[model samples]
Target: MSTPDQPAAFKPPANDPWKGFRGVCSGTLILESIVVFLAIPAIAKLGEGVGAGAVVYLVVLGVVMILACGVQSRPWAMGLNLGLQVALIAGWFVHPAVGAMGLLFAAVWVYMLYLRKDIQARIERGLLPGQRD
Candidate 1:
């Protein structure tokens, strides 16, 4: 059913769990930071329905994301990103106005995960200009 020239799919071990988690974490930090920068202030001024606590949460999460994104390794990023995503998702239930931002964050996180297959290759061979991985 398969040809010799075809390469097998690269799958991280199920037991490792953390690999996927780290990828999500890394993506979360990057995306969440952007959302917070744009959404929180907008909601504060435009909506006026979202409370100060929600704004405070976004600011704090932004700070944590800044620290988490500084890590160079992918696995580390994944863990942090997972925690961050969980926090954002949880926030959605507590604050629907803020929760809307998670959709954007989730979209970016999924997109980043889709490109994760090249992580090792990029670390070894280097990324070309405008390359996705």
Candidate 2:
């Protein structure tokens, strides 16, 4: 029996696939935000001659990373995350450690994107036998 307040069946969340790849990406972004912020004081201590602008840039980047993570489920968010990766790589000039972090995150980002595509393909081709279409 069905009622106006209840459907005849239940539906799972469609947007997240491949065991919550989007969730993984979102978590990675939040973690990156924290790492970026933690590097701020080190940037100041480097004393190879840094300006307030450097700190400001890192702060703004950290904030953007956190905010963007919240919207990772949106299609455009993939691009935003990639852009942040590039920025992180560019931050290498500030310190080699930032570049290393960027490389690691970039690798994870690529893996997530690849997984998403694979999952979508399986869903479309009806090959994912254990799951609903």
Candidate 3:
């Protein structure tokens, strides 16, 4: 306990939950961005006027999420995703079939967010690699 010139003892983590969840969420965002981007042209051709705007917005938002949060404390990412979900579901009232597919995407996004929240909490509590922000 007396350590004027000595450093404290180092203790490694029992496990790193943050890294695993980070990988999953980051990968999911990348994949979802790709899918949405690719589908944009087709959707536009199908006469969905908002397709381009939606694709651009999603791609930009996903990149920003990765940069700002990197799947760690990704509050922006999760919130934006949930917002999209609500939008998609509301869209169902206008176009049932199309919105149904959107709902599936929304469901997947929500699941990913659910999986990442635990990691975010850990990070916030100073249980992960970095210090609290």
Q: Top model by TM-score, which number? A: 2
Off by over 4 Å in 1: 1-31, 46-48, 118-133
- Which ranges in model 3 have alpha carbons more than 4 Å from their true place? 1-13, 47-71, 74-77, 84-101, 113-133
Candidate 2 residue lDDT tens string, 1-133: 5589964453343544544777788888989899999888776676575567767778898999999977876779899999999999888886787788889989988987888788777766545555454
Of candidate 3, the 10-residue stretch with the lowest lDDT total is 89-98
**TM-score for candidate 1, residues paired by index:** 0.58
Q: Once model 2 is optimally superposed onto the true structure by TM-score, how far is the C-alpha of residue 54 displaced, in angstroms?
A: 1.7
Q: Which clashing pairs does model 2 show?
A: none
**TM-scores vs. true structure, each candidate:** 0.58, 0.74, 0.49
Question: Which numbered prediction scores highest in lDDT against the true structure?
Answer: 2
What lDDT score goes with residue 30 in model 2?
A: 89
Candidate 2 deviant stretches above 4 angstroms: 1-19, 45-50, 127-133
lDDT of 1 by residue, 1-133 (tens): 3368974344443343335546565555766687776766677665445677777887887778877866737446655665677777677754675666666676776776656656555433434332322
lDDT of 3 at 13: 49
